[model samples]
Target chain A: MIGWTRRNAGDQSNSEAVIQLTNVDYTYQAGSPFAATALHDINIRIRKGTLVGIAGGTGSGKSTLLQLLNGLLLPTGGAVKVLDHTLLPNMQKPRLNALRRRIGLSFQFPEQHLFEDTVEKDLMFGPMNFGSSRKEAQSKAVEALKSMGLDEALLKRHPLTLSGGQMRKVAIASVLAAGPEIVMLDEPTATLDSAARRELIALLARLCREEGRTILMVTHRIEELMEVADEWIVMHEGRAVFQGDADELADRSEELDHWGVAVPEQLRCWAEWTARLPQLAALPLPRTAEDMARRIEEAVHGFEKCESTNIASKEGSQQESAQELNDQADSSMDAPYRHEKEVSACVTS
Target chain B: MRDKLIIGRMIPTGSRVHGLDPRSKITAMLLFTAALILSNGWPQLAALTILSILVLTATKIPAKTYLRALRPLRWLMLFVFLFQLIAGAGNGTVNLAAADPLLWSGTWGPFTLTSAVLSSALLAVSRMALLIVFTAMLTFTTTPSMLSRGVEGMLKPLSRKGTGAERFSLMMRLALRFIPALLEEAQTILKAQAARGADYEEMKLKEKARLLLSLLVPVTVGAFRRAEELTTSLEARGYRIGAPRTAYRQLIWRSADTWFTLLFALLPVGALLMRLTV
Candidate 1:
């Protein structure tokens, strides 16, 4: 328990690299007839305590990259450094189970791996394996499940009997019970509905913001992750083509469509918003719907303030102009992606 | 490791054997099995070996594949050979012309050893090897779905005895379909556990046992879940037990089928004659 807790204390160092990869090359089934190089000369640097979203299309080597993060697959060339452990290609890997215990990887469709009948045993499994006492493991399991927003009463029930979403959460909770500092998830919200996806994202954000666990979530649903991810890493054909903060991402997001990732809808809406109304263009880019609404609220407030000043100057001719201005603002803000007339009119309105 | 196995694998080649009706292939396999069981001595064994080699060569698949099928069972074959050699040595006969000549007399801790048993052991090992190779040939030639359909057609007559033969074939088809799916799933589970600090390659026996328990339960659950979904889909498609149905891809029998099956048809009769007279 002490090692598990203290092991991640290094991950809390904000500026240092939690994961550093240098010229890594991975070929699946190397030396076999089917040997195909999945990754070649991949170099990446993930800073400590950042919730980073990894975006890519299918067969872009996103899952293969996650496997390399925790030494599940050794590099065929170059080096990988995570925390204090450094993995060199073709070198006899020094005991890596210690490194694994500190980095909890929640794979895609993880619930399908839950073999234990009872949820309690499944959650406690990781902790127990890493040498926690039964009592200590039980507490850790409870703590992990609670953090995942699961009811503690469900711990004694069979994991198989749980709903698909619940089983997925419990499967992740089982990994978290080991209490690794760096958590990497591969498309964690892949199969969930929109609302469930939001909840899962919020939970992951909480793990980063409050719990101080660095997360690298690989996903195809880039728009969903756009709101919460502190930064993004875009991969294309087994290469990290882009890595930057959300503002830089929004700036370069138009080109993401060429790489097979749709420009997140919010970014599209923001582009339309800024291109028409040049006044608020300098403001920080908003990713979520709420963020967009807040930005629009500012625009509306600015218009109202300007309208009030105009109304004071032209007192007798004010009422009719105010009504028209309100109509113009509503039409422009509502259909943000619509024609240029409403977008340009709203700024003057 | 499982991927290296060549058993129950179909190699696609439009050869004389591969293009035959699956029922003809199935019949040939049955006849071959009977011949293997009834053949008693050297001449019949030689006929079976020649027949196996000819049928295998007709498939155009590499001979190495048939050998690869036997690779996994090599250890078991050796153990069986040793057991046979030990058990037959109690006859109290010795043939020690050459050095050793598979002969060693006197009690060595457990039992007595003599000479003549080595001949019998070689025969038994050869018979076992032939049986495995012949079965491997049948699997290599026929695709699983076609094989299942052939078995269903062959077993159709048993439905008259109320033994539910088509159900057995259906069960077999389902099993054949799911084996690869299950293997893939089990691999994923193994990786998931490894990511959670269950070091399978380095764990002690007790820890390995625990890892197996973790693997087995999820796989069982996944199977049931898959079965439930399959049942629903089948029912939705109007599948019914013991209902009238027509073949979508009807089996076409040709002269080449009869020509191939005729060779196998002679062996079983020849074997029965040998069994009775020899």
Candidate 2:
């Protein structure tokens, strides 16, 4: 249910760094009347085969940063090196094209790009562009569609006729059709219903975990990505405000709002819990609902055992009502959990 | 590419031109165009040019902003100039049989050019440049809502003919409003193509055309979706084309607006006066 797992079956890409940026700067419409600098002196290294979440407010250069990852946007300053290809200011187009083929980029609402008559043609479009044979491209399309949890029968139907959720999946599948090593998506879950959002997240997770692909997603809401992401990059006012793991991100939750990003709900709730229950302050951060609930269960169990010891030595009257209270609490807390997070404080304790 | 589009975009300078009634601006624009057409010779053009400068100064917007509005029309203006030069139109003396003793003659595969052609080209370019500047001033000063309202106000007389002027104006408004949004989507799709290894910069002429044509479906799809949403929103808000409605922001014409209107009214009248006499 969680994201990161080292792939051993095949295609275990051993590269330490998949994408690198050195002193990168980008300015929109440079040397024009309305030229505006989007990024400056930006340095970033995205680890291979990890789900990296890029968070920023609107116009925070998150999208600009995505363009520079491949050669979609040549850096106005410095260089962007993707794999063995270095995107210098005067880099050749053939080299850039080669580099871009290794990284798949999906714009927000990529479904809007599905222009072919049928889903099959749309899926085959990318692979065919990369010089795949018709037969190979056809097979790749089917495989991509299947990987995205879409029915193979959808290949014949017009993409516009599909339901919104299905269309979104197909759009993502088309990006995957080309078989790129890294997939960078901009606001992938935007406008999706909560269920669809979760499904998309799961599909992206599967891409990273199962297929061993590197994913860099640009999303304003951090909660959904925080769960699956191995690393987080926060952008504010054209610069990296913070770049770290989830724990560090959680620590920065209080200041995130000032920087114009939503603080993760779990982090906010966890903050309240720590403020109320100071004894549990030393506990590790929870990534999911189950993790938090399990931690609470442990804390309650600890408090109960202490109560039992006091009760055994002194009185029995208070024990019955407290036990009744415990039972009521347990009954109320009993609900089906996704069991997403593997780390549980209760087990470790 | 989008940075150059200033037609639908309004720069809020809080100037007197911006504060004027939309009706007044619309009237002035009509008068200006009539004056431009009526005024033919150098003296009339010089008078109109001076009048334009006066109006331009009154607006207080930077000259560069006005020039930016002409940026998109540069190629069109050039084409018009070239067409006037080659097609032997305007100023009878521009013909091959001409009078003023050719300053320079050059052959380019088929056609010959002379001083008469150059003079006529100058005339066309000047006229075009003036029209672009004046038109740009109107959009730069007025916001899109005012523009839509101004158009509707101009079309008020045709309402009796049952041509659905309101609906037509609304359509125009929507088109103007979505230009930037559509451009943004286009930029995004291009980025997506690059990610797919389309290599837009390195693409051949045929490849680029194919890529653009491929996006036509999604762009149309997106437009339809937006139109649907807009319909729902309008319906929800009780919007009807022919319904009687109170003015949300009433257009009020002040004495200053009248004065501006009167000042611009001089263009056509003065041009006629110049044509009759000088």
Candidate 3:
């Protein structure tokens, strides 16, 4: 069924767990009256060589969770372990610096970390800071630029001179130059156009597949991550409300919406179509467009016998009244009350 | 909105000025300032003023754009001019007796409204204007990272004395990068508060201070949180501060830099010679 179990089971062993957050709880400082809990009882284990998607609405503590993953932030109540180094609350400064080198993090915006004169120097900044030789760093910078689909000629141009999408790629490549095993990006495609967003996703997916790097990406667009994600973790109001495979997400689609997440349109359409067909109601939920199409075809065939019998019965009765009832049912599907009833019936029965 | 913030940002136009190393530009600007300060006669000031205007014209940035850079400092410039004109200890003499009678009537203790004081104020304003324009030209041509690295390179010789020059340069770069982000965040927070009927701007002075005080808690907290996340992301990418590493864009000196250095050095030398000869 291409569910969570199947995906996780298919992944190779010995990939190593790169990040382990065990029962992590985080709270903001208490001086302010508005100080609130940011994260609660979060336990997540990310394996190496997988692209993990973290999906959550605004103020769901997604940013807080990402910081904890790389030891940038300490858990107020629990432990966070990244690449053999563990960080508890109030760790000493020297230990934190030691943990930073193995993790490459790209902040949300392209401009925040870009301060170099030329694209080349900015890309080399991280590698150089980590004690890489000048020649090796320059080579790594060129490779990073190529990986981001930027031209070698751009090496001498100022980063601010690049177009919006190009600047974003440069910013990302700067991190990639450092070659961190675990790469975490926060809303990397937030402001990019569709083509740029697609290119970024493809590049990140390839990075995980070709290089076997562990990628943890936090995105608001759940549908965009559908094809690439190995695991989908959904957060709601400071808690990990759901964590499992992509297909498992379909089962919790209703819960996701109630928690203020915009459910993927494909899943919503599948749920609607399933509600109108009595025979299709028994089939398992589908997560993607292909799965939904296949399920719909299977249901159509299962209803073929009953549809033929119903057609024969309608032919014998008042055809006008039968046709009128069918039209009314189709139109009623568009109504909010009817839609809720159908979804509730699908859920309960 | 984003474009407004990016308007005056340093664009790499590949102009001769942009190609020069930032350290050379910094040194030249320092010398240029010294020449302005050392000038005691009108001829020396005129030479310094003409030199600054020539450099400003060479930048190729539009006149309107350069003027816009002065908008932020306009009030401060006005304040300096007014303060010097009104408060200067001047000789008690009616130097402008042939001028308007209304100007002669206004007297503040021993200070009289005279052409000498007015000319001095004008000279000061002109000098300040030239300084700002020159400094803006430097920033407009060079990117922040190059400027920081240039500063770091300049301080390399002092590193043997156990100074954290590289660290300071890094902090400067980080600060420049964070300013816009922090401003945007503050705007968002302010909007959110206003949406909740906080009306911070409409409040009384004491109330506004209280509101501003309340914001510091969240803003500082948010800043620290962002710093934490940024640091983690940076560390995950194998960034190590204070580690020895090679540079991708190596700073090189060119003929243009040498010319600019010579011009900067000549200005002060000319001013000093004029002072001695006079």
Candidate 4:
């Protein structure tokens, strides 16, 4: 609810705003009989160098939001501001090649768009379009390939001949070859396996952390992004229902189910521990299972120590201390709820 | 460009035209095309145009969709009009003396721009537009599967022994089915390329051609991949070609279909009467 009522995201200072949308509305084939409104009154501000996850279900307008950000589709009603350029309704759309070169958008199943005979030429396509010299683009292509954890020798092979995971990585490398300042992907790890998805996300996190490139990734499975995302935007029925840091998302985790987003097990476990020990609420929400387990153990032990000290001062008896120990065991048994078991299993795995 | 393509797009409005049998609709389309081609003079063409607009309106689809179908062929229609004007080959059909007065017949100019030739050129373009609109109406009112069934039913007599009709019908069905999907895939690829800095809309004509050539490879490859997958799925379901599969949707030809087709049957007769009298 904190981000829901913050309709005035445009009031923020411009220094940190890399992308901003104020009262934006987009309709597919607007003014036609088959026209559909994909987004409505969307107001958001994405700061520079942050990895944001856009979570939504099918037909929730996640893809439309990415297209609007990259100038692939102009907002039919309101303004779309990306980088230094501003787009308004009915204005002459100026050439966006310069703007597009800095804001790379990789569509869902981007590998299907790869057409070049060789992987190296496919990777170089973006940089060459942005007016880079052939030699510069070639080196950039190699850099992108290496960054994607791909072999340099694979560059000479046809893109279609590669494995599905490798083709997806090569496709992503093609988008990164231009060295964009902002990268937006629509379900980049959609069909990838768990290990491949982890590797791709880790690579994207490194891109944001090391190269200072802002990344916006669209995904329905928020669990995969819980550990990496700095911020979250939950969309429902074309409206951004929630937009905030992980703590706010945790606070409103119950509302996520209503928005068609599943609450990750880690968040549920964190909630259980915070409810049991109110003292844990003072700390930041844990993003990983190991962090959650450590915080829960430390808080539970500290609470037990305080209880034992109180019991010793009030009634100095062996029987009451034994009772206190039994009570502690009972609480610990109760603390490992289903969510905790799942999170602990995640940790062990 | 994706939005402009109205072919293979069916808008269901539950109108009378939408309820008629696809066989009747297809028959009407054939009859309508015959009438359109047979009509030569201004009065007959005007009648056919009015009839086409009436039939199109009966489908309850927006006129803008029909017009959008013609948008892709505007240049080709213009070429047809110019070719007709320059050729001016209507001398055998219409008596020039009875036609409109000649504007120029000077000795220095072997070619002449007369009112008759101009009207004939305009008529030719109108015919082309009507043909496109009528075909669009067929697709707009009927889904691809229904149209395929209708085709199979119509060609059943031709293939009394073999599976030729069913095979041809299935091929037509698949081609019809893939038109919209292929267009959608093409649009996705186009957007993906645009995102990677090859903005098709901003490119010059030559660059646009080159970009389209690049897209052709991916689109064809994607089509082949899709076809292979579809083949696997069909085979997994034990779908053998011409395996005497029973119809899931039996097309019932009601009296409404008869009435609907009769309306179109009148057009060719009216055109023939006009031709004889003229």
Top model by lDDT, which number?
Answer: 4
The whole-model lDDT of each prediction reads 0.79, 0.77, 0.70, 0.83
- How far does residue B275 in candidate 2 sit from its true spot (Å)? 3.8
Q: Give the clashing pairs for model 2.
A: none
lDDT of 2 by residue, B141-184 (tens): 89887888888877889788664778887888888878877888
Docking class of 1: acceptable
Ranking by TM-score: 4, 2, 1, 3
Ranking by DockQ: 4, 2, 1, 3
TM-score of 1: 0.79
lDDT of 1 by residue, A1-349 (tens): 0001222324434578899999998888675333678887888898877889999888888898999988878888888899999988787756677888889999999988887779999998899888899999999999999999999999999987899899889988988999998999999998887777777888888888778889999888777777677778888887888888778988887789877787876788888777756766788785555445545545644555565565454533334443444344431234333334533565556
lDDT per residue (tens digit) for residues B228-270 in model 1: 9999999999988788778788888899888878988999999
Q: How would you encode candidate 3's per-residue C-alpha lDDT over A1-349 as one tens digit per residue?
A: 1122224445544567788888889886432222478999998888888888998899999988877765555688888888988888776632443345567777677444455578887787667656688998899999989988888999999876788899899988887887878888889999898778878988888888778788889998887777678888888999988888766887678888876688976557666676667666566554444445545544443354344555554433434433343344321113223334533544454
TM-score of chain B of 2: 0.86
Off by over 4 Å in 1: A1-14, A20-43, A58-60, A71-95, A160-164, A233-263, A271-285, A293-341, A344-349, B4-6, B13-16, B40-64, B89-116, B157-165, B242-248, B270-278
The candidate, 1 or 3, that scores higher on lDDT is 1
* Residue pairs in candidate 4 whose N, alpha carbon or C atoms collide under 3 angstroms: none
TM-score of chain B of each: 0.86, 0.86, 0.82, 0.90
What tens digits encode model 2's per-residue C-alpha lDDT throughout A1-349? 3534434423433548888889888888776446799998888887788889999899899988888876777788998888788887655554566676678888888888888999999999889788799999999999999999889999999998999889888988988999989998889889988788888898899899888899999997787876778788999888888887777887778889988998877777677666645666788675655556556545544554564555453335334433443444321113112121211332344
How does each model score on TM-score? 0.79, 0.84, 0.49, 0.89
Candidate 1 clashes between residue pairs 3 or more apart in a chain or in different chains:
A115-B218
Note the DockQ of each predicted structure: 0.47, 0.50, 0.01, 0.79
Off-target runs (Cα >4 Å) in candidate 2 are: A3-15, A22-41, A74-79, A85-95, A276-279, A303-349, B89-111, B157-165, B276-278
Higher lDDT: candidate 1 or 4? Answer: 4
